[model samples]
Target: MGFNMALLALRNDFKKWSFILWIVIIALSVYVFANWGAQGKIGQPTSVIASVDGDEILFKEYVE
Candidate 1:
């Protein structure tokens, strides 16, 4: 019975630590993603795909 109680306590501690680890990971992921998105690359084109009427259209513009 004593051994069982200790095992149960260890299991609970493991679960608690696992939950905290996941929370920290998710928070860091969100932080990185937010910073990346704020760079204004969402609609900007990286390369020209085609030219029509002497006007160049970007790959990003074509996709959107």
Candidate 2:
């Protein structure tokens, strides 16, 4: 039925595109595998490590 037709069409497409599709899939897999640890290397606590002002430097005191 429809499944058989789809199978036939899929086979045709595979014949036409198997090589290009394989290249694309291999490239994507390599890129993904290489960048697998990139996520863990991001979002680190990049903080301001120094301060010169006093602890009681409030906005109300500065406004007066």
Candidate 3:
């Protein structure tokens, strides 16, 4: 009975740590993604060369 109680406590602790680890992983992923594509623009207009109807065509797309 004592061994069972210890095992149960260990399992609960493992679950708690797993939850914290997942939370940390998600937060880090969000932080990285938020900053991933923010390095090039310094308050400049995007590379759009033309607009048709209401859709703007990017220069990169035109080149491709």
Candidate 4:
């Protein structure tokens, strides 16, 4: 009996706040997906990670 009452109260509280919950969820989803889409347009990093004096340092060579 007590457990059922607690569950009912929790359900009512969720119903009251459902709209705010949806807004928060949608806002976070939009922010995450927007950033994900932007990453593709930014392009990948160059093969040459750096340059020193007159020499260009390739990423692979730099790692070794």
TM-score of each candidate?
0.63, 0.35, 0.59, 0.40
Query: Of the pair 2 and 4, which is ahead by TM-score?
Result: 4
Give the range where candidate 4 is weakest over 10 consecutive residues by summed lDDT.
40-49
Question: What would you estimate as the lDDT of candidate 3?
Answer: 0.74
What are the RMSD figures for all models against the true structure? Answer: 5.1, 12.4, 7.0, 7.2
Candidate 4 local Cα displacement, residue 13, angstroms? 4.5
By lDDT, rank the candidates, best first: 1, 4, 3, 2
The clash tally of candidate 3 reads 0
Better of 2 and 3 by lDDT: 3
Full ranking by TM-score:
1, 3, 4, 2
Residue 17: error of model 1 in Å? 0.3
Once superposed on the true structure, which residue ranges of model 4 sit more than 4 Å away at CA? 1-13, 41-64
User: Model 1 TM-score?
Assistant: 0.63
Task: For candidate 1, write residues 1-64 as lDDT tens digits.
Answer: 9999999999999999999999999999888767766876455556757989998876645222
Tell me, by lDDT, which candidate is best.
1
lDDT (10s digit) by residue, model 2, range 1-64 = 9999999999998987988898999999778755754654333333344444754432321110
